[model samples]
Target: MMLSTDNHAPLRRTPLYGLHVSLGGKMVPFAGYDMPVQYPAGVLKEHLHTRASAGLFDVSHMGQIALRPKSGRVEDAARALERLVPQDILAIAPGRQRYAQFTNADGGILDDLMVANFGDHLFLVVNAARKDADEAHLRAHLSGDCVIDSLADRALIALQGPKAESALAKLCAAAPSMTFMDAGPHEVAGLPCFVSRSGYTGEDGFEISVPAGDAERLAKTLLENPDVMPIGLGARDSLRLEAGLCLYGHDIDTTTTPVEAALEWSVQKSRRTGGMRPGGFPGAEKILAHFDHGASRRRVGLRAEGRAPVREGALLFADATVGEPIGKVTSGGFGPSLNAPVAMGYVPTSQSALGTKLFAEVRSQRLPLQVAAMPFVKNTYKR
Candidate 1:
């Protein structure tokens, strides 16, 4: 994941900085924050541990905002937000959340986000690198109807794995009862927190947003659980990649639309053409047109035929022997769970079908790969 573009700025530290250092975390710059790339267990172990048991991640760097409607109705806030993203925000019930993207007027993505209906208000979590822009966008557009409160005094953490429920339930008794995408205020470890039963790792997990002052204590308490290990950005990236989740700057960006990124499922039918309230959002014209017709290129999974892992920015080709560049690998790395190299990239729609053969140029050598189904691993989200 490309954390930040400007490297000269001073790196900020999260509330868990001390905890990470104490745990022997290897610190690195990420999204203008001094974050841990991995702990003493290493990236491979952290990745496997998260898959086998549970892993705790410090994601406080991401931005969190609360949108309160002036009219004291969440539906009003949802309707106002509809002018920004294409998702069916009005359909989000209290204590539930949905995935969405902020698109530019040109029909390109600005940033992908998670929006949760918290009864009286809507909670939004945006990418760390794009938080400032997103906040400004919201303020510039919805200031008249909504009160945007940026929750900078809170810390965010994600606990993910098959054992996540049991581990979190030990501290937050109500954790087990919430199903996937459920989001609301809850008392966790006797501390007030905003809990969401969702994650980027494709595992059953909860993202807890707690007061910054109590974050360290909550992290330590969760770490006391035998199944939970401190994971860093390295494992977090691989986990999400293997799960087929898009990294904001890598897989999807200003140049890519939701349809081209294979995220059409997130654009609900309610917002598409012929829906009750349609074509009101930014880029709705071009985006919805892509829905009606089709995008020239599509994001597809690439399975390398050999053990060599193809990194990002590698140029793709149609034939192994001779051909011009056909596509490019946006996110590529070794999938620890699959024990093989997997990648996601954009290819011509004609070459995007499953089982279609393709080649990626790695170190001047063309390596064979094939278009494959995504989620390299099956998602274990709790329904």
Candidate 2:
């Protein structure tokens, strides 16, 4: 659902543009880039192939930023960032990563991003669509002691699936030893790179950040292995949807709060009551209140009753098809991994329990829906 629509304006291309085209990538406008929606093997094959083997993904369109404290104190920079997000940045040790979000004054998410500690500085990777706004917000709020540097000179690529370890280990031995969420510098094929043991798919993988000039060579080097194949945006969407991961604009947006989005677990313990540091972030009062007393509505996974895959914006109704709508699907599609239609939507807390039934008003038909548990496909993360 984060896909971009075609327009008269020219679309930007990543450094891997020629390589994607060489591999017969079906390029489309996405997040301001002419990204591949799928390869010649197609979305279904790409999805299944990623689950079974390894899939190479060009994610350079994402924004990568680094924050350094001007003052000699590293903890000062961490504290300054903590003031913008509810997560505990001070607790993230060097070479480790944590998920966080920038919230508005009303506790609604501005964007979800990954924060990694690099000893002297903190590295942040934000969504492409909101990168400019996120950078401005950080500058506006963060104290003058901290400096934000956008890493426009780098490109990011993800090698994901069961074979990700062995494939990457051939290039960098340190890769396989890293557990999920671990990030650090590594040398790959004589190239200096930063490899993170993380990815969007619910699979064991590595997201590598390399110099923009060398991105194509790095990608080609990885593709030389028989286990890896080029994956595109289409399979990426279905894979994440099946894994129950929230998309930036679809599953989460400015109007949806963290509590209602079921992302309370990301909030660090130190930020909550009875902790060392409490209530310093933006929207702390309203967000923490919902933590104590749960939100009236909560995001839940839904399973449609037939072959038809319910899609985004499908209205949901309770009991019968004719009544006031209860909720609507935020992200939905045919899950290639599950071989069934899976979706995520917001519903009343009363009807959020597992096994509770609802109806999705899709194309004038009342499709039976069950409030199912998330991650329709179990996560294969390297814990």
- Whole-model lDDT for model 1 versus the true structure? 0.95
**74-141: candidate 1 lDDT, tens digit per residue:** 99999999999999999999999999999999889999999999999999999999899999999999
lDDT of 2 by residue, 273-316 (tens): 76789888878888888888888899999998898999999999
Residue pairs in candidate 2 whose N, alpha carbon or C atoms collide under 3 angstroms: none
TM-score to native of every candidate shown: 0.99, 0.98
Task: Pick the TM-score winner.
Answer: 1
Q: Give Cα-based local distance difference scores for all models.
A: 0.95, 0.91
Q: After superposition, how far is residue 243 of candidate 1 from its true place, in Å?
A: 0.4
Which regions of candidate 1 fall more than 4 Å away from where they truly are? 3-5
Report, for all candidates in order, the number of backbone clashes.
0, 0
Q: CA RMSD for every model?
A: 0.7, 1.1
